[model samples]
Target: MTTRTLGRLRRTDFPYYAAHPDVVYLDSGATSQRPETVISAEADFVRADYAAVHRGSSVATGEATWAFEAARERVGAFVGAGERELVWTAGATDAINMIALGISDASQGLGSAELALSAGDEIVVTEAEHHANLIPWQRLAARTGAVLRHVAVDADGLWSLDEMRGAVSSRTRLIAFPHVSNVTGQIAPVTDVVGVAAEVGALTVLDACQSVPHMPVDVSALGVDFAAFSAHKMLGPTGIGALYGRAELLDVLPPARTGGSMITTVTMDEAEFLPAPNRFEAGTQPVSQAIGFGAAADYLASLGMSDVRSHEEGIAQALVETVTRTPGVRLIGPAPGAERAAIASVIVDGVHAHDVGQFLDDRGVTIRTGHHCAQPLHRALGVPATVRASASVYTDIDDVSRFGEALGEVRDYFGVTT
Candidate 1:
């Protein structure tokens, strides 16, 4: 939103911001702050109605089970998916690992032979991916004897459409990439990547952790076979994430983690698993957290994602212009006026990123400083670390301007004027 709306929201919805007037949080890319509605939804659910789901025949069990399933439907509709497409996981990392490990199991003759990977099959990824997205595929390759091919990023840490196209071929089994670069904030063309994968008869997977929270994302419309994202990043509670897969694909893919409530029938040696959402959810579900997540989705939906994108566009322009105008601060990612997410990652001329972060912290501003779990992207940019200031629905112009002023003073604070 614009400053007016952001300021209004700051006072009405966000308790943390209202309580701590001095602290300006600029780390929404890492994890967004929750609104009062989301906080109360979880607490209210736990306090008023807390019971095990899918295991009992009592009234409490039916009520709790209804709430839990209803939460999934709300979150699913938020992302433009059917009620059955969403599968609950711990977080984005767990969701990605679930797919990778499920593929591993398939290749090892565990469940669906249709999903198996051979020695010559290749899995594609971009160098801009975070470690969570990268490591899972590496392990999958190691376990299945498949080859991993990376679509390398350029000097600005970007993978072009041509580069992505060149990386896919007849041998490609899967093409997985992020919808947005967490470091560069460069938004990728989902349809382009999905088209390339479809041409090569490869399954498409999207690491939608960064894009889903900030902009509108429809997994089914994007034509991707599967997508993963985290609840915490979307202003929802932690310990719960979502994996959206085509019901056809999810039905056959082996469950990475197997336990009670996931199977339809279990006898002596052989057991049959349930369908999509239920098959993936094994143990007692994260009932309260999912309810909170649904409330978060409803909150965003009420504001409208189109308005959210328009608001972030303003923040992106401000962040880029602020960093570039300040001396000793080099802005990363696309040039000004380019299509990018509302995240500003910068490298100071002399001071280290951690020191820059501390410098901001001293001035009552909080930012994220490090490789951002994206060592490959950092290495591509030839930097050890960067200080990233990201924006969200509640971020105002004052927050961005404060970050710019603090960043400009970092070199001077460390006596690095030269």
Candidate 2:
């Protein structure tokens, strides 16, 4: 393999191992590679501070409890949310499920909220959502006898703002979409979308899985009823994620998964639930992961999200230019130089995405391939799948250049180039 070995990543201020001089990772959109600090933080918790959080009695437990809540405050500060509004879950999928399950419980008489769903009620989503955001809404509509409507996307996998505006009517009860489409890399105007939904008194849910990790996010400014994202994508451990909801709203929503920790009191026939966050957390929380995630959030903050965003944008721009000049390559999503994230999904003519990925791999370049969990967006763009190269804060110009060089050879290897 042609090696693009940079050197020891420790030579740089960025905590991640970017200078391996042997690897060029480009799949940050799916999950980012962790820094040494973030990785060690998780290990530190298990090796030393392994007590249960929020419900323990021992002195060690008390210290652990303080650490746990401190982690909550850190995450809250990073995302522009408050401790009262945040509920911990397993991941973005788990968080989304929590919201849907809570709403479903409300409709099914488990909650205090006046959630009355009929066949005429509608739940709106976009064609560009990951399955995590789409499937839950589909299940909610199925269970509530509500209709599901989707805002269509353009040929570039961009959803029309006008169509989304039209989709919201009196019948629309809830709307859900991603802050940034994972496949397309296009940043959605979240405030605009939420504003429209708010106008009609519809609840809004945002899948912030892509945005929270890459850019500075202020959930308060988004003005949505709920938002969810995973810790792993943001360089934390896999088992922890967060769901942010309005304190007043979560107060009325019922617990989805019930057990020991989530209850206030229990009787043989009836049980009273705890407050918003604890009521939803239910079982043994991901205490160690939360501690580690707090460290990750702190690390990102230290670097400043502004710096990280600018670095990845530079890589994306360079990758876009390289793709445009390469033969038989069609860039997916918005055109190059458009306001986008670090991801670039592209199709190589006469080659399956898997083959393109394999070709890149043989040359020591790592890029993500396939539908990227947004199959609807792929279909709308008229491709079965695409090879996606996503950069991260640690990614530099060399990695992007390697990806471009490898991609330029793909058409020739597949006999697509004249």
Candidate 3:
């Protein structure tokens, strides 16, 4: 790894990064700060190569199709999936919805007529799921008459492996869960969970929104049936993401949306959909954004996920130490020393999460403050929301220290000193 390829590790050169001498950003889990290369790549695509892909026979269409499919290959390489296994979607939310919709279609005589879900079948999730993962399964269960079941978490927001193991049974149809929790920073034992599900002949669905961007994720090696993630979280442009499913599984699953590019032949009463990726990616795709996403993936690959994970761990450890030293501050999620992400959620004595966010903002430190789309987890943890500070590859030690100092002053600002 050459230093030039890695670029300067300092907090500079970050696109949309305005360095106030005292300002710091820590809300990377919500959305990461993009680099200049990613921004320029998207701009260049729009400026030089904007055209409708997978349609028409013109030279421009060929170029556009090449760019779009090349992005599929780039993103596929990043996650250890094949080019044909990657399907473009609007975002992670859309990807999850697509999976739910595909399953619904499979059950409803749209495609794969042999596999139909009915009442008494179970769909498993966890108590710590984000609404994106939770609501889709809720609707799937309700619509298909399948019962929804979930593994419970303890007070620390940690769920035991045995708890999940016990939940799987012959009736379990699918298991949808996050590889890493957004609020708790808790890393789930996906392999173990998948093992139990496989024993019951159930499918494994992973919400890799947090894991794929930050770490080196090999979906094939992980043995997941399907996985979903967004581009913006990994320094790519928004409105673009990818879903990876086993080639065999996607070939049989029907796409949620139907349109021009997704079909091969259509008659008055019947239609034949395209193959795995094309079938799911209906209509004109996000070409420019996909191009930019490929660049982002390339950049991250150049940096290497091992280095990214190590650097992020350094920041997380320092931030957790600072939180523990601070008075009247309570750190939520997995305990320190647990395998987790660089995200840390905290609650201050006599201070609301929103108020703490405002206080941090006044100090020029940016952090996320909310339920983080994990309302059920918050409800289980006995709080409405929390203040979260997350890190990315662009983040430096100085940013972590600045945010820690700002956090130290929070209790004093609210006069909740212990």
In lDDT terms, which candidate is top?
1
Model 2 earns a TM-score of 0.95
Writing each residue's lDDT as its tens digit, candidate 2 over 335-370 gives 877988988899888899999999999998989999
* Model 2: ten consecutive residues of lowest lDDT: 1-10
Lowest summed lDDT window (length 10), candidate 3: 1-10
TM-score preference between candidates 1 and 2, better one: 1
What candidate 2 gets wrong by more than 4 Å, as runs, is: 1-20
| Candidate 2 colliding pairs | 5-21, 5-22, 6-21, 7-19
List model 1 lDDT by residue over 1-418, tens digit each: 4754754565468788778878989898999989999999999989999999999799999999999999999999989888689999999999999999999999999978888999989999999999999999999999889999999998878889999889888999999999988888999999999989989899988999998888999988999999999999988999999999999889889999988999999999989999888999998889999999999999888888888888888889989999999998888888888999999899998888999999899999999999999998999889999999888888878888888888888888799976
How many clashing pairs in candidate 2?
Answer: 4
Best by TM-score: 1
Model 2, 256: alpha-carbon shift in Å? 0.8
- TM-score-based ranking, best first? 1, 3, 2
TM-score result, candidate 1: 0.98
Q: Tell me the number of clashing residue pairs for each predicted model.
A: 0, 4, 0
Alpha-carbon RMSD, candidate 1: 1.0
Once superposed on the true structure, which residue ranges of model 3 sit more than 4 Å away at CA? 1-10, 18-22, 113-115
lDDT of each: 0.90, 0.85, 0.85
Which of candidates 1 and 3 is the stronger one according to lDDT? 1
